[model samples]
Target: MNGLIGKKIGMTSIFDAAGRNVACTVVELGPCVVTQVKTEETDGYQALQIGFGEAKEKNTTQAQIGHFDKANTTPKKRVIEFRDFNAVEKAAGDTITVDEVFAEGDTINAIGLSKGKGFQGVVKRHGFAGVNDATHGQHNRQRAPGSIGAASYPARVFKGMRMAGRDGGRRVKVKNLKVIKVFAEKNLLLVRGAIPGHKGAYVILEK
Candidate 1:
């Protein structure tokens, strides 16, 4: 798998050749530095570890500083390892740019953490139509989960039942999103449709 670590900038619309405004999510891809190359003989797996963004030395641990020092780069804010990265052979300290790998119109998958909505109800979280009819003595059940268990038989709620709990803040992968544009100089990529997470969230763009 060929991929890069990037950050979600925001959403914007651009005019296509058909003169229609198409929505695109803007992302700032790397300038990633190769931090380590794990070989099967050494680590029992083949993977390429890359780093992006800058991190303060004070905030970075000594082990991390030594790791980056070996790579001839400073402390990186984001470090990701791609397993079975067989697109091209790269050594530690090498840099990968956005334009060198991706282009316009390519289909890619974006993986990110979705926005966190703390505790929620079944009506909002699980899309339950809670107490829609206000008349028949249903006053406080406007957003209730409504019957959870059976009176007899198992007499217990199933384990996998969709009830109210934590919503969002999960690793979400949006697949088959087309690449709208790629600006190599600015290290920006505009992809079609909305991706997971809020602005400035880290995303993994996989092709």
Candidate 2:
């Protein structure tokens, strides 16, 4: 397997062998169950549909319950399909753990939803300088996105202007994050640098 579904546990600093404090994010990786296996002839592509995290049977739909039952496992909260996983031979109802896929010193990518910052201005969202010193009779217009369009030739604002509306809460991927440590017993992965999303958010780790 080349990837696993995981959760962002939070961030912490750990001392490296060089005695330098390295900031890292803690992720709780999975013992994911293969719910479905797709082949080129069957689904027009080769992929594995894996399920992670626990879900109560009452909260799960009947179809999903049957799907999990087919895998001989309980309901899972997050299900993701990974293509081009040709490194190992796996079948439906197989379990893949994090330790079997990742190790320390390996580089991987993490994908998750970024934290939401609602209704922000260009100063915060687009990193505008914000009216320089806020002087020259500027009061509340410091954070305003000034002079968005021309008055004569181009009368309308352009479609792709960098003016802010909503910020974040979108899919973000952080690549080449070095794996600092992997605790197989606890199912924790310590990776250098930050990944997307808030605490307890689900993340996908790929190699």
* Candidate 2 displacement at residue 77 in angstroms: 0.7
TM-score per candidate, in order? 0.92, 0.93
lDDT of each: 0.92, 0.91
Residues forming the 10-long window of minimal summed lDDT in candidate 2: 130-139
Per-residue lDDT value at 73 in model 1 = 91
- Model 2, 81-177: lDDT tens digits are 9897864788889988888889999999999999999989898898998766567777777677888898888789889999989999999999999
> Model 1 off-target regions past 4 Å?
none
For model 2, the superposed segments whose C-alpha errors exceed 4 Å read none
